[model samples]
Target: MAFSDLDFLEENFIHYAKENTQSNYANKDQVPTTPGQVKMMQELAKQVQDYGVKSRYNEKTAFAIGCLPANTAGVSPIGFFAHVDTVEYDDRFPIRPQVHRNYQGEKIILDEANGVFLDPAEFPDLRNLQGQTLISSDGKTVLGTDDKAGVVSLLAALKYLHEHPEIAHGDLYVAFGPDEEIGLGGQRFDPADFPGVEFAYTLDNGRPGDFEYETFNATAADLTIKGTVVHPGEAYGLMVNATTIMTEFLAALPADQVPEKSRGHDGFIMVTDAQSSVDRAHVGLIIRDFDWDKFLAKEDLVKNLVDRLGQKYGPDRFDLRLRRQYENIYNGVKDRPYVVNLALDSYKKAGLTPRVQTFRGGTDGNFITKKGIPTPNLFNGGGNYHGRYEYVTVEQMDKLTEVLVTIAAEHARQSQTGRDERPLKKYW
Candidate 1:
């Protein structure tokens, strides 16, 4: 059952995959952080207009917003999000997407000289993709399938609805934003742009059946330690090494509570980077937890560690700063179960089993959920995201297109009859 054009999916995915849209964190002060992102966002705004979507590229927020007016009048407006940028990748070599038609579950060579290959034995999911079109990078750079697959699926669904107006649907809004890889895109999103949208979904990562409503509550911490810079031969009590104090602080963090050790609703405190000298030291840490109480406890643990270190060294010697990055999507969506129920229903209609699980990482939905519209995450239909080994198939993308169309049609039908208000179970 072909839901959308497979040729259109492959061609559009390859066309956008070649664009250099890698986001730069160093340029966070800018709206998009790279010229390539701006080019893609603006181009998407123009392209969607051809599919009966009224669109615009907002320079203030770096979001390309579009709205497809409803044919059915009773249903409320719903929205969708997909990023226009990829994570930071090597730009020296351009992204070249290779397509394999009717793959027979055999090993496909990406770069023979560089010893890069996509084997079914290594990625067992490839075995299920037999007889389908597979797409991958040439192994020099990322394939940008993280959210580009999401973008293409959404576009195909929109085009389908435009051509067949009999399939009654409500107003649909789509926003393609920049710097999502750098985590700045959603932070700067203006909610007014989505005017009157009740709920939204971000078609980000995960395989076809995967769905997530809970994400980590996140915080970023920075610590600075000051010490006297006396020579190694200086008097014993006068010389203080900042590196030693930094090491002590790092060692005091809970060993079991880290990204590697924590999984499935568990959270950890991670030291992203640390640099030290005899005169000064700085450490960057991130704290994540799914539970609100646990998240606060983790924050308190760091503050207490700093307090104890300040007592040993002078109180003035330690300075720490903690900033809230984003909150758990569960916090906002927990009370509004219809948003979750609606997607799960749509998935079943699209012939997918609902696999509701916790998202270990955060997404644009985390921030947007806080903005009063409870947004959950839907699958982008791929695996090995944000890397050279990333791959997505035409069938997987068509499945996503099917899911989006189902969500729209189902939402319209449910509006006329009654809303699904089933409570979301806490899987964590």
Candidate 2:
């Protein structure tokens, strides 16, 4: 079934975007970290039931799960995920999505009085979206297009399949998860929620043609330094400055290996924050690498540097702690090449040239893949994400819906005929 329902996609996108589902990192201990996300997830659970799927909202993980039963026999189930929470934004202003119908490729003033404009010069991708129904923010706040577009696209796909039951498909599972922007949602996802599902896709971010199976392997590091304090007049050879020690530790980090200096396929160690006093100092950092060996080497570098400093000063003067965050998605899917080949084939069937690229950052797919379900990221159809300039088009979202439907039907066909077991190409 060709799903061309622009109105359904646009209406749901706009309705959800205005709901202020921004996640709170300060309240990370909370299930969803915000009440707004829970409200939306609950509503989505009920909404999916209208399309003949058995749906429910899981309170523990804050994920709304739905299952569409298969019409075909002996086909394995597949799943798709979309996050409901957006990134942290200014709460003083409310999100108000502005819709432009049949865009003609001109600069749009998101707020004329505030002098905020979405110009084509600043965002060249806007030119490619001409003649499509474009949606943007009011320049006062974000439009929440990052994953909301993904949510609406999934809804359109589900609605399409429900309306046309003749299109044969295997069991389809959908999950509307929370806190993806803050990196907590996928970590809590229970693979048991998706019974019998072998693989899945995360409709997170990218253009319509973008497909990513590789992401950064990440870890967080915390360093604490202790120093002796004394009065300056009587502190000769008796006082050790913690700030000075913190500066030395910072200087030891490789300058060339940082986010500012790194790009495609390169790994980096970044100091996210640092604070120090005469008595104590603390440093927080994160490490990201596509290669597991390089990632471990980076971690070793931190421990080695701290050990050297401890020997120089004292063993009790410095303490370092490292925590693994998420592993690269490629590590899980490399052996299962069919998971990738099927999506690329479905993209081609939907008339989009496959543009496979490495995602330099992490996604919900990272954690989900670690839980034994190989999930990769697909496009959510938006530009300038996580800010006021964010925008998406009805046509781009429609393309995503088509891709979702194609994947379900194609997976069933391949199971009956033969699976695409093509060797996955190295895309670094």
On lDDT, the candidate that comes out on top is 2
Model 2: how far residue 187 lies from native, Å: 1.2
lDDT per residue, candidate 1, 156-255, as tens digits? 9898989889999999999998988889998888999989999999999999989999999999999999988877787489988899999999999999
lDDT of each: 0.93, 0.94
Model 2 lDDT tens row, 1-428: 32569999999999999998999989999999999999999999999999989999999989999999999997999999999999988989989899999898899999999889999999999999888899999998889988999999999999999998988999999999999998999999999999989999999889998999999999999999999999989989999989999999999999999999999999999999999999999999999999999999999999999999999889799988899999999999999999999999999999999999889999999999999999999898989998889999999999999999999999999999999999999977
Q: Where in model 2 is the C-alpha error above 4 Å?
A: none
> What is the TM-score of candidate 2?
0.98
Residue 166 lDDT (model 1): 94
Model 1 weakest lDDT span, ten residues long: 227-236
Residue 368 miss distance in model 2 (angstroms): 0.8
